[model samples]
Target: MNIAVIGTGYVGLVTGLCLAQVGHYVTCIDIDTNKIDQLQKGHSPIYEEGLDKLLRENRQQKRIEFTTDYDMGLADKQMILLAVGTPQKNDGSADLGALFSACRAIAEHLSTDVIVVTKSTVPIGTNERIQDYIKQHAVNNNAVSVVSVPEFLRQGSAVQDTFHGDRIVIGGENTEAVETVAEVYQPFNIPIIKTDLRSAEMIKYASNAFLAAKISFINEVANLCERAGANIDDVSRGVGMDKRIGNHFLKAGTGYGGSCFPKDLSAIIAYGRKVEQPLSILECVQRVNEKQMDILAGKVSKRFRGLKGITIAVLGLSFKPNTDDMRNAPSIPLIQKLIENGANINAFDPAATETAKTLLSDKVFYYETIDGALKGADCSIIITDWKEIIDYPIKLFKKHLARPIIFDGRNCFSLKIMKENGMEYYSIGRPAIFPIS
Candidate 1:
């Protein structure tokens, strides 16, 4: 299969690399010349586990290529995957301008029969719009088919998830196009669910919204547990054992913050409002997530009387571990709140420091090492549960912090260890462990 993936972002990069790894000739197209050049040199702009190795291997094997020229990239391709960004607008709707622009560019250059599959997360009826746009503008109207094939890969484990995902959904008006896509993915032994274009688009948003709801639900319960003197961990375990709930996304943290959950929840709520049937549950979910971050800051403030002029160390900057993505990370707002209360911030992330520098350049001091970030700090806040941060020397923490106050947002350490260390430890949905003074 000759595949051309437009927009070499996270989804596009992974999709192109995975396809090329499976022996398909894949060419990734992007307007950013620097990024395209980087990829051509076997360099990945984004950080993903197993992605660099696969991309490098495929490039070495001459199965994968990268280019900035749209026409040249799509000229010989049988499948053009539209994997561009549909960023959320301020009004909470998905800004599909990039998607539509990509469609127009594809239409202008598409010469032969091809399936234009959307691997981007889009709203319902987006595929229909793409189909209409192609027919109206495509050079060869009768030769092109627009299909919606939404990606379900999760970050931090995208490569593994791609090959091991439970199922793939393909939506299109053309059976031949759907069959072509199915054949393309035949290397990965996963179930394929065929449906209409709208259903396929809805599936992506629906799945993300549901997972966000689960996180919010648990966080809400955790809040109640804090007041009621109940342990959320035990409560979650008891509920998760019911087989129906099945313990995933149940760990209560400083709420869900990433590219997908927060944006998807807002987009779904906006989509509902468009049809005059608002998603009340998602509205609550968004509110709870926002409040959770503030709650974490409040916990720190209450413990220290006030955060004014205090030196606080933040242990993680990425939204989650194993990737350097800081988009919508909870640490951003949490750190900002502390700074507003006159606190000086010092932070460390094994991988996300570079990306975090872009987001919080002057707001906080970046550290080369975790211990360096914690040195002489008044308090510590663990936001992202990176394995390295979790496995840091416990004694170093005891020696460095001026107050030894650790507010763990991700519950990285066990309660027993904190108790034994005689440090003031606070975590989500669990009782605060005060030091024995």
Candidate 2:
């Protein structure tokens, strides 16, 4: 199969590489000359685990190619994938400028019958709109068919998730188009759910909103546990044991922040409002998620009486581990609050330092290593639960920091071990561990 992927962002890059790995010829199209140059040189523009290696292998085998030429990239391609970003606007609705631009480009360049599959997360009815848009601008009215195929891959584990996803949703009015898109992914052995274009688009937003709601719900429960002297960890464990609930996305943290949840939740709520059937629960979910970060910051502030002139070491700048994406990262707001309160910030992450620099600029200092970041710090805050931060040597922590006050935002460490190490530990939904008298 010859596939052309438009917009070589996270989803496009991963999709192209994964499809090429399965023996399909893929050409990823992007407008950024620098990104295309990097990809052509076997370097990934984004930092995703195992992505660069797969991309290099596929490029070496001539299975995948990168280019900025849309006319050339779309020529002779059987399937065209639109994986462009649909960023959220001020009104909470998705800004579809990029998506529409891609559609217009495809419409102009498409010379034959092609399946235009949308892998970008979009609002419901977007596929129908896309079909109409292409028809309006296309040279041949019946030459293109639009299909909605939303991606559900996580950032850190996207490669693995792409290959092992539980199900693939394909939504389109044309059966032939659906089947043609399905054939491309037939080798993955994942179950395929075929539905209408609207339902398929809604599934992506609904899925993300539900997961965000779950995280917020659990965080609220964790807050209750803290006030009620209950252990959220044990409660979560017991509740997760039930087959009905299942345990995924139960862990309480600072908040759910990344590219997907915040944008999707906002878009769904806005979509509901537009249709005069607003989702009140999701509104609360968004509110709670925003408050969670403030709560964490307040906890840190209350501990030190005031944040004025304190040196704070922040471990993990990315929203999650194994990816360098800083979109809507909780640390952004947390660090902002700390700085506003006169706290000096030192931060470190295994792979996010360079990315973090763009956001933090001179407001925060970036350290070469976690230990260096913690040195002479009054307290340490763990934002992302990267494996390295979770497994960091406790003795080194004791040796460097003047005061070993650790705030475990992700609960990445054991409470007992922090106690044994004689560190003042503060974690979500757990009893505060102070130095034993």
Clashes of each: 0, 0
Q: Lowest-scoring 10 consecutive residues by lDDT in candidate 2?
A: 135-144
Which consecutive 10 residues in model 1 have the weakest lDDT in total? 135-144
lDDT of 1 by residue, 1-437 (tens): 89999999889999999999999999899999999989888889988999989987998899999999887899878999998988889999999999999998988997878889999999888888888888889776548888899999988999998998999999988998899999999899999999989999999999998988899999999999999988889999999998889999899899888888888787888989999999998899899999998887899899889999899999989899988888899988988888888999999998989888878848799998988899999989999999998999777898999888899898888778999999899998888898787
Residue 178, model 2: Cα distance from true site in angstroms = 0.7
Compared with the true structure, all predictions reach lDDT values of: 0.89, 0.92
TM-score of each: 0.98, 0.99
Instruction: Residues 1-437, candidate 2: write the lDDT tens digits.
Output: 99999999999999999999999999999999999999999889998888978987897899999999998999999999999999999999999999999999988887878999999999988899998899899866547889999999999999999999989999999999899889989999999999999999988988898899889999999999999999889989989889899899999899999999999999999999999998999999999999999876798899999899999999999999999999999999999999999999999999888888888748799998988999999999999999999889987888888898888899988888998999999999999999987
All candidates: CA RMSD (Å): 1.0, 0.9
Model 2 TM-score is: 0.99
Clash count for candidate 2 is 0
Candidate 2 deviant stretches above 4 angstroms: none
